[model samples]
Target chain A: MIKVYKELNNILLVNLNIKEASLENGDAFKAEVIKLFDKYHKSIAINMSAVEYIDSSFLGSIVSVFKHLISFQADVVLVGLSKDITNLFALTRLDKVFKIYNSFDEITNQ
Target chain B: MAQLASKQFLLPNTRQSIKASVQEVLDFVINSLPAGVNTEGISFKIEVIIIELLTNGIKHAGTIETFLDVTINEDNINIDKKDFGNRFHPGNITSLLVYDVGHKELLTKDGLHSMYAVVESDTQIRFVCEEENGDEVLDVSNLMEHFGLLIITKSSDTFTYEYDVDTGLNTFSVIIDLN
Candidate 1:
């Protein structure tokens, strides 16, 4: 469900290659990202362009990752969220907690 | 106003099954809509409602089988779910608050967007969204876990849960008003 696209300037770029992020793959997704974060010890940017929908279980895993990274003073950002997905974040009030970018270029260029 | 479509599905209490069932229901709801209806807004909300309802049964209630009923009306959508699982413990819920995160305040009442939890008895608890209002701050600090119920209540116009002790049945009714 996740692909390690590349690492640029110490920032890990990962792509979530799933149309729906739910309980079925949430645990695996969390473990993969945790492993990547442990190995790199750097900031991570998750590209969620492929995710059309997400359930609470899946969103919980993302929250876990954010809390984990925040504890260490590292950063975790999201990019390429669909309008509905963006609405989901806003609904949960997580839009204030996570740094979300409209596109990959926005993060890469900055 | 008028009934447009109605369907039901019996699914096992597994993550994979729940995920697939949600997709199937979304497809059915979309396909059954009238020709001029735009599903861009309501599709995601329906997916969230079903996923949360089924996930709750599997995770907390240890349910083996979940039955889902989807009824789409002219002005709203109603989802009815049933399963035999452990009774709910409403005492564990510390607080139930629906905040408009964008505006940084609680929403009192809107079209199908009121939220509150009521404990009728030891064997019965209801989460109703009718005409209640609050002015609490938008706090997401301790909302990491056990928020499936919140998501369901927030997404739907009205959500009511009733567990029958006599028959050991848990019934969850959710209604989403369309714009």
Candidate 2:
């Protein structure tokens, strides 16, 4: 469900290869991401370019991971969101809290 | 607006089942629309609405039967969802609650600028989010993750919930304008 693209400057880039991100895999997704964070202790950039739909449960899991990473001074940023998906983030006002980018290279280059 | 298509679905109280049903519902709506009718926006809204409806049902209602009716009209899409679970306590949510990074507080309307619940009547409650058009930012965090009702209300033109005492049915009706 998730593929690790690379680790650059202690920043981890992971890609979610799922069409729908919802309650079905919410817990597992959170666990997997948390495990990665624990092992690498690096800031993570999630590329959600393939996720067409997402629900509050999955969103909650994302928030949970963010809370866990914050204590370690790590953050979770999103990249490559579709228009409607971007609207969803804006709708819930998460765009203000999370650093969202248009592409994976934006984060790696920065 | 005339009814273009209508269908009902009985889904299991599981995320996988409900997720699959939402896809079916979205596909049905897409096939029902006339040629050249742009559905890019409405389709996304409908997907969010249906997922929220069934997931909320399962989360609150437990192992109860759930049914969703999708009716597509000329200018609107109507979704009626029913779950035989516990009754929702809208009155319990009294104040305008807002949460930020490290804390949450209950404030009056003047102090807050985001979504809150309002008890419209004995059997109905309307969620007053930031904007009816759903374009404005909610100015709140999703940390609570209690956004199912708020999301449904903001995504639809009209959103209402009713509990039938005799039938013991909790019904959520939503209408999305197709214009």
Candidate 3:
């Protein structure tokens, strides 16, 4: 199982072990991300410091989780987005949708 | 060990040299593979898939002072190509999110850009490719400039990419069922 740690606020840090975070762990990953939404009414911060490759299914999972959180007026932020990962997000126009940060410090300050 | 697979290659340090390198290995795999498999769509698929991975590494992974390790087995294949330069930053890995299956609402008129162009099935070769009259001449050596991202996804039943920055090494693997 991938590591999921909930922080002081509604901060959810998901540390993926591999550089490529695609559909291999799609359902379980979705479930973990959604679990944060279901429990935390505060802001949700996803720390993707360890991931490198996130494919379409992985993007959908993130979007699906965001939808659930937004319904509850929650905020979501993604941290440590790599150049390649950020490019893909930008390509899909998801860069506008996601609150991406270079590091945890950038988001934690906000 | 019952599960023993190996891929030994003498990878020269130039971009042009990799074409023969990729094709030779693909040919070896094609020739040595189990028979009666339809490689119709997949035959074209290999061009995109192989080039994307190999070229990306050649272009970005930077230095070339090492060998590539490729492992093929019954279930999956593991391809590890490392240059082991000073810049292999283990901490900063590039993550890309491409969609193989599409969203009902977000369909692009140009099919190549769409990630959802693929179908879901664990079996194998569940990819969809539109009729493309591409450039007549193609060099796997210069793949990034020519090939679209869709080829990589369409070529395999499953694909994964990883590059270790600390190690300055990149690895990509594709698993397909020719049966």
Strongest candidate by lDDT: 2
Best by TM-score: 2
CA error at residue A26 for candidate 2, angstroms = 1.5
TM-score of each: 0.78, 0.80, 0.41
**Model 1 residue B62 lDDT score:** 88
lDDT of each: 0.75, 0.76, 0.51
- Highest DockQ against the true fold, candidate: 2
Q: How far is B7's C-alpha from truth in model 2 (Å)?
A: 2.8
Give the DockQ ranking, best first: 2, 1, 3
Evaluated against the true structure, the overall lDDT of model 1 is 0.75
Model 3 residue-pair collision total: 22
**Every model's DockQ, to 2 decimals?**
0.42, 0.49, 0.01
lDDT of 1 by residue, B7-52 (tens): 8888888876776888899999998876666687788788778888
Q: For residues A1-110, write the lDDT of model 2, one tens digit per residue.
A: 87899988868999999998888888999999999998899989999999988888888788788878876889898999988779887776667668999988887677
Error of 1 at B162 (Å): 0.3
lDDT of 3 at A8: 58
Can you tell me which runs of candidate 2 are displaced by over 4 Å?
A1-3, B34-37, B90-113, B131-142
